[model samples]
Target: MEFSWLETRWARPFYLAFVFCLALGLLQTIKLYLRRQRLLRDLRAFPTPPTHWFLGHQKFIQDDNMEKLEEIIEKYPRAFPFWIGPFQAFFYIYDPDYAKTFLSRTDPKSQYLQKFLPPLIGKGLLALDGPKWFQHRCLLTPGFHFNILKAYIEVMAHSVKTMLDKWEKICSTQDTSLEVYEHINLMSLDIIMKCAFSKETNCQTNSTHDPYVKAIFELSKIIFHRLYSFLYHSDIIFKLSPQGYRFQKLSRVLNQYTDAIIQERKKSLQAGVKQNNTQKRKYQDFLDIVLSAKDENGSSFSDTDVHSEVSMFLLGGHDSLAASISWILYCLALNPEHQERCREEVRGILGDGCSITWDQLDEMSYTTMCIKETCRLIPAVPSIFRDLSKPLTFPDGCTLPAGITVVLSIWGLHHNPAVWKNPKVFDPLRFSQENSDQRHPYAYLPFSAGSRNCIGQQFAMVQLKVTIALILLHFRVTPDPTRPPTFSSHFILKPKNGMYLQLKKLSEC
Candidate 1:
C-alpha cells in the first residue's frame, strides 16, 4: 500500500529515526519508574490517607478547608503523603521533631511554591538557595541590626500615626466601624516604602495612590489563584491563560516600580560620590545597603540583583507585617479583657498617647505577650515548603530521599495538642517568661525556626509592638458582633471577610 514511499532509499532512515525516538522515550519512562519505586518503598513506612490512582490526594487539596486539612494532619500525627500527580509527592510534616529535623537542614525551597513568586520578587533572598542565599543573608544582616532599626523608628511611627489619624477622622465622622486589615496593609506598605527605598509613599494621606501598591496586592491574589488552579502550574499553559495575562501585567507594574527605585538610588549614590560626600548618613535603608553590599569577589550587586532584593524587602516587610498586626488587633478586639490589659501596660509605659521610644517599647511586656500569642494562633506565613536537597531522617527511623518535597506546617506545629495544653485558647500567658521557658523552642515558630528563620523578625516585632501601643494609647478596640471576620488560609492566613472592629475613644470606653 505504501510501495511508492518505501521504494525511496530515505524511507529506511526515517523509519529508523522514528523507532529511535520511541525507544528513547521508553528508556526515560523506565528510569523515572525505577526512581519512584525506590522512593515509594521508603515513603510507604510513613502513614498516608487514601489516594486515587490518577488524582492522588489532589481532590483532598481542592476540597480543602482548614478543619479537613487539620483532620488529615491529626490522623497522620507525624507526616503524610500528598501526591501532586503520578510523578510528584510531598511528605507533609506537622510534628515538631520531624519539622525541626527537616528545617535544620538548608534545603532549597520547593520550586512548585516558589515558582509562583519569582515573577514578582525575581531570584531574591526568599527564592534563592545555596551560596547565593548565604551571601545575600550575610550582607543584609547588618542592615536590620538593632542600631539601624532604632534609626528608623520615627519613619515607622510616622506611618502608624498616619493610619491612626485616618482612623480618628473616620471615627469622628459617620463611620465608627471600619475594616482594620486594609488600613493596616496600607500602613505597612507605606512603612516598607520609606524603610526600604527611603521614599515617601504617603499612602495614608494621599487621595491618589501608587500603582505599584495596588498591583502588588493584586499580584499576590493572582499568584495564589494560579497556585490552586493546578492547570496553571505549567508555565506554557499558564502564560496563555487569562490569569497569566493579569499576573504578567501586574508583575510588570511591580518590576517597573522596583526598577525606578533602584535607578533613582543609584543616581543618588553616584551624585554623592561625584560631590565627594562620603560621610555616612545616620541611617541606611534597605536600598542603600543593597547598593553598597559587595560579594566575596568584591563585586557590587547588579541592578537586577538589587531589584530582586528590594522586591523581596518590600513584599516580606509589607504583607507579613500587615497580616501579623491585623491579626493581633483582631485577637485583641475579640478579647476585650486582654485589650484592656495591653492598654494598661502601654499606658504605664508611655503615659497618654506619647511616642513609643525604643526603650519604652521593651517595657510593654504584657503587650508583647499578646503579640506572641497572636502569632502563635495565626502565623503570617502559615507553612513553609522546601525541596529536599539531601536525604532527611526523622526520629521515627523513616527516611525521605532527596528530591522529595517537604511542607513544614507552621500552623500545625503551633496547634499540636502535644505541645500546648489548649491549642485554641486565646491566652497571652502562654508566652509569659515562665511559661515560655517550659515549652520546646521549636514548639512556637511564628517567625519559623532554625537556619532559615525570618531575617526580619525583630523588625516585624518592633512594628507590631509600636502599632499596638499607639492604638491602645488612644482608643479602645472591640469586636464587631454583627460582622465577625472568618478565618481562611491562603499564602497567608487571612480573614475571608475584612476584619471589622469597633473603636471608641479611650475616655469614653
Candidate 2:
C-alpha cells in the first residue's frame, strides 16, 4: 500500500501512539484482573448480589428507566446483595422490622441521603434528619390538620371537575380513544400548583404549554436520564471526569428555577397583609405556610430553604398523586367492574353534584381503598435511599458498614407475595379496615414509615380523594381502545401511551 504525503511524516508517530495505547490497554486489563479479587473481598465483608468482576451486580439493576425495579426486586428477594462496583447494597429488605430501622432517625444507625439531592432539600422537613426533622414536622403538623385540609377540599374538587370537563371534551372528539395519561399528568400538576402554590398551572387548559409545567416536566425527564446514567458511572468518577460539568450545569438550572419561585413568594408575603382579619393569619396556599413557618426561636427560613421545601412539595406532592391516580385509572380500565363499583360508591356518598368535605371524604371508604390499592400496585417513589453513618447490625444478624448505599426497594415490599395475598391482582378491598390489619405494620408502606416518611402523605391523599371522587361522580371512565396505555417510569411513573378513556357524561344518564 502506498502511503499519502500526509501519512509519511505523521504515520510513524501515529503507529507509535497506537502501539502505546495497545500496551496501556493490556496493563489496565491486568490491573482489572487484580481489582476483581479486591471486589470479591469487599462483597464478602458485606452481603452483595452475585456480581461481576468489572461491574459488580450493576447489570441486575441496569437499564431500568421504565420503573421496573419492583419486578427486579421481587426476583432477588434478599437472597444475595446487589453489587454495584465497590458498593454492596441490598435490593430488598425482607424483614419489616429491619426496613423500619432503615427509615427512622431514632434507630441510632446514623443515616444520610445528602449525596444526590441539593442543599435546598437538605434542611427541609421532608428530607431533614434528627432534631431538625422532628421540630419541623411538629411545627408543620397543625398546618395540615384535618380542618385545615378540609379548606383545600373545595379547591381540589373544582380542579378535578375542571379536569373532567376537559377530559370529556378529549374523549368526545377523538373516537373515544386518547392517551389520557398526559392529561392525567397535567391535571395532577394543576392540582398541586393550586393546592401547594395557589397558582394554576393551566396545563389542562393549555395542554402543557405553560413554562413552569413544561420546564419541570422536561427537567424531570432529563434528571431521570442522568440518574440512570449515573448508576453505571460512579459519582466520584463523574466529578473527576468531564460528565461532572453536566451534573453541575443541570443542578444550577434546577436551583435557579426553585430560587426564583421562592423569591417571588417572599416578595408577595412581605408586601401583603401581615395578619388578615379572617380566621387564622394563614396564607391561602403552601407559599403562605412556607413563608410564615418559623424555627424554634421564631426566625424565618432563608429564601433557599423555603424554596427547597417548596420544590420538594411541588415535586413530591405533584408527581406522587399523579402516578397513583393514573395507575388507579389504568387498573380500573383493565378491570371495568371495579371502576363501576368505585363510581357507585362515590355516587352513594355525593348524590346529585354535592360538594365534598372532610367529613364526607372520611365516609368514602371505597374511594380510599381504591387509592390504597393503586399505591400498593405501583408506588410513586418505588425506592428509598439511606446510608449508614457507622456499622450497624440488624436484628436478623446482618451488618452493613458505614458509607454503604442502601436501596430500600419499595416495589419489592409492596409486591412481596409473603406480605400480601394475591399481590399481583388489583384488589382494593384488601385495604378495608379489617383486611388491612392483617398485613405487617410496615409491609404496606407506600408513603414509607418512621420519621423521614413523607409529610405530604395526608395532603396527597386528600387531594387525590377529591380528584378521584369528582371525576367518578361526573364521568364514567372506560379504557380508550385505540391507544390503550401502558406505564413508562420517569420521575413520576407515567403512562407509556396516554391514558385515553371514554367519559360517559353521567348527568345525561
Candidate 3:
C-alpha cells in the first residue's frame, strides 16, 4: 500500500523533495569535513603545545596566561601556534625577524581588537582599516609634528607640577608610602586634556572628580572584561548580557562628555575667540588643527568622526602614559643607583630647577637611557595584535596562510636571550650609542615599529622626560620592600598588586 501511494502524483513530488533534501545535507557535510581536514593539515607545519583533541588549546588559555606563554616561546622559538578548537589556530610571534616581516606589510589589525574596540573607539585611526585608516592617519599626522609637540611642553610641565604639589603636601604632613599610580593616572588625564583639547580638566586640582574621567576608567575595565570572555564574542549574546548593558551606559557618558567638549571648541572657533589677528597667538592645539583638516576627496570629518578620533586619543593617551610613567618611577625606586645617576644628570643640566625646557630635556641623556631600558623591560603595551591579509613567509621559509591572527609579544621580544644579554638585569647603559648600534633595529619595540607605529611617540617621550626630570628634582623615591609589584597581564601592562613608593623630600636626602 505504501509503495502504491508513492507512485501516485502527489506522492511522487513528495518523494522527489525528500531525496533532494537528503542529497543537499550529504553534500554540505562532505564540504565541511574537507575544509576542516585541510585546516588541520595546514596547521601541522607549525609547533604547538600539548592540547585537548576536542577542546584544542582553548582550555589552557581560559584566563590571561601571557606570563606562562612567555616560557613556552623559549621552547618554540620559530613560532608558537595554539589551536582554539579542532581547527582554528593562532600564532604568537616573538622573534624580531618574524615581527619585522609581519609588521612591514600593512595587514589589518587583529580581528579580536576590531571586534571589541570599535564599540568603544568607533572608526578611529586605531581601529579603522583600508582607505579610511590611511586618510585619518594623513589628516592627524600634522598635529603631532615637532613644533606642535614643543609648544605642549609648558602644558605638560604644569600638569606635572600639580602632581608634585599634591605629593609634597602629603610628604610634608608625614613620611608615608603612597600609591603613586592613582595620582599619575589623574595627572596623565589632565595633561592629555590640556594638550589635546586645550581644556583644563582639573583632574589634578579638583577634589570632586570629573564624571568623564570616572566613566572612562570604568569603561576600560568593562571593555577588557568583555574581551576575554570568549563565549560572549557573539554580538547578539554580548548585547543580551549584563556587561553589555554596563558597557552601553558607560559609553553614553563618555560620548556625551566628548560631544560637549567638541561643541564648545567648535563654537569658540566660530566666534574667532580661539584665533585672533590682533593678538599674538600661541600654537594651534590638536583640536583646532583636526577641525580644519580635509582629505584628498575634499571631505572633512563628520561630527561623529571627529568625536571618534578625539575619544581615541583621550583613551589611548591617558592609560598608556600613566602606566608607563608609573613603571618608570617604580623601576627607578628599585634601582637607586640608576635613580641617583639620572638625578645627577638632571641636576647637572637644570641645577636644582624643577621646570624642563624643550632643549634642556634633550640634555638628560642618562635619564633617557633609563627610560628606554624601563620601556624595554616593561612595555606599556606588552603585545600588539595583527591579522594576515595574505600569505606570509618567515625568514626560516615557514609559510602561514592568510587570515591567521598573531600576537607580536613585545614582552617576549625584550626578554629573548638570543637578542639581549643579561635580559633580567636593570642596565640602562645598554641603550648607549655604541651598544644600541650593535642591536637589531626591530629588537626593542616599546612604541612598536614599521609604518603603523604609535603616532604619539614624540608626545609621550616629551611627557616622560618632563615628568621624570621634575620628580627627581623634588623627591628622593625608594621602593617599599613590603609591597613590591608583580607584573599582571591586562589590556595594558600593569602591576599585579600596586606600586607603593616612599617619597622623601630632596632636602631630607
Candidate 4:
C-alpha cells in the first residue's frame, strides 16, 4: 500500500526534476568547454579581414620604424577591423560627422572616457565620474587660466632662445643639421617640468642627471612603447607561463619616481608657501594650484592622487605638443606656399619677432586654422575609446550587444571625402568660417568633442603657437632631399625616424 502511494505521488515528479537538472548541467558543461576552446583557438577562429595572426593588425597601428600606417590610413578610406587580444573592434568611421557624435556621446554621470583611461589617468580629472570629476575640474580651473598662463611666457621665450642657441652651435658644424623632433621634445619637456614641478627641478639644464624627471621619460617607454622594449614576445605559450621579473622591475622604477615628487610637493604645501616675496608670486606653476586645490569639506588631494594627475598632464600636455609641432613643421616643409602664408600672417602681426605674447597668439586666427588642419590629419592622441554603458542603438540602426568597447576610427574619419571636400589635400582653407560653419558638427574632432575633450587644449595651442612662431622667425625649414621622411604610429603619433630637415636662417622682414 505504501509503495503504491509513493509511486503515484512522488516518483514521477522526482524523476522529472532529476531529468531537468541533468539537462541543465549538461548544457552548462558544453558551454564551458566551447568557451575554453574559443579562448585557446581565439586567434584562428575569429573572422578578421586578412591579417597575419601573430602580428594581427598591431603592426599597422603599432608599427615599428615605418611610415606605412600613416600612408595606409590616407590611402585606404573605408571600414577596417583589428584584433586586440580576444576582442575584435571595428574601425569603420570615414565620415567626419559620425566620428564627432560617437566620441561626444556621454552618460548622465560624467564624460565617457573611463575605459582606456583607467590604465593611465585613474581617478584624476580625466577618468573620474560625476561629482568627483566636476569637483576636480573646478579646483583645477585656476591653474590653466589666462592670467596664470601669462606668468609662464618668459620661460617659453627663454626655452626658445636656449633651443635656438643650441641649434646654432650644431648647424655651424659641417653637415651637422640636427633632428628637429628631439629639439622640440626637449623644449616641450623642459617647459612642462618648470611649470608642473617648480619645486627643485632643473630639467631645463640637467634632465639626464635628475632621476625623477629621467624616470618620467622612462614611464612613457614602459607604457605604449615599441615592441623592441619588450623582453619577451606575447603568445599562447607565454600567457600560461609564470609572471616575469621584468614587469616588476619597470613598475618599481616608475612608482618610486612618482612617489618621491608627490611627497615633496605635499611637504611644501603643508609648509604653506602659497604666496611669495613682495606679496605676489611671479608664476603659477601646476603645484601651486594643485596644492591649493581643496575638495568638498575642506579636503585636499593625497600624494598618490597628485602623482597620477601630474603624470597625465606631463605626457598629454607636453609630449603631445612636441609631437604636434614636429608634424606641423613637417607639413609646412612639404607645403611651402602654406608656410609662406603662415609667415606672412605672422609678419603682419608681430613683424618677424622670435616670439609672440599669449594675446598676440589669440589674434592669429589663420595660424590657428593651419594648426587645426595639421592636427586633423595627424592627431597626437590617435585613438578614442568608449565602452558601451547599456545596450543601445546607433543612428545606423544597429543594436550593439552590451559590454562591447567602441573604438572611434579617428584616422579613417579624418580622410573621409564625403564630409570633407578634397580630403587628401592639405588645405587650411577648408577650416574657413564659411566651410566649417556649414559642415556637420562632427566633421572635425582634432581636440575630440563633448565632455572629455582635452582639458589642456587652449594651453597646448599657446605652447604650439609660441614654439612654431619661434622656429619660423629664425629658420626657413625645407624637407631634406637625401631621404624620404616618414612618421611612426604609437599611442602618440611620432616620426618614424628623427625629423631630418634643412633649416636655413631667415632674413628679417
Write the residue-wise lDDT of candidate 2 on 1-509 in tens digits. 35686678778898999999999999977786666554455346444434465455444444443334445445655434565454333334645666776775343221323444542244577567667666667766666777668778887777777777776666664445555656676777877777666665567787665455555555555445444453424567657655466556656666776677667666665777435511342336777776777876886667656776777777777666777887777777677788888888888888875577778788888878888888888887767766556666666676666655566667677777666777789988898888877767888888878766677789888887887878777666777656666655554666655566666666622
Expressed as tens digits, the lDDT of each residue in 206-245 for candidate 4 is 5534443344444344344422222233434333434324
Per-model TM-score, in order, reads: 0.89, 0.81, 0.89, 0.79
Candidate 3 residue pairs in backbone clash: none
Candidate 1 Cα deviation (angstroms), residue 148 = 0.5
Pairing residues by index, what is the TM-score of model 3? Answer: 0.89
After superposition, candidate 1 runs with Cα above 4 Å error: 1-39, 52-55, 58-64, 173-175, 207-210, 273-282, 295-297, 507-509
Q: What lDDT tens digits, residue by residue, belong to model 3 across residues 1-509? A: 98777579577788899999999999977886786687767667887788777566655344556556667767776567766665456677889898899889999998888877765677788888888888999999998999988988988888888888888888996677998887888899898888778886777878436777667666666666655555566688988888888888888888888889899988877888765621333767778878999988788888878988998888777878888998999999989999999999988898857456889988999999999999998998888888889999998898888887887988889888777887778999999999999889899999999888999898899999998988998898998988887765566776656689999877421
Q: Write the number of the candidate with greater lDDT, choosing between 3 and 4.
A: 3
Candidate 2: worst-modelled 10 consecutive residues by lDDT: 105-114
Q: Give the alpha carbon lDDT tens digit for every residue of 1-509 in model 1.
A: 47877667668888899999999999988987886676678687877777676666766555536666667766677778777656567778888788779878888998887888886778888898988888888888888999989977878887888888777777885437888888888898899888887787677677335587678667877777666555677899999988788888888888888888888777877776522422343567888788888877897777778888898888889887888888998899889899999888888888865466899889989999999999988888888899888888898888888888788888878777767777788999988899988877788888888888889999998889888888888778888899987764667676767789888765321
- Each prediction's RMSD over C-alphas, in Å, is 3.5, 5.7, 4.7, 8.8
RMSD of 3: 4.7
TM-score of 4: 0.79
Better of 3 and 4 by TM-score: 3
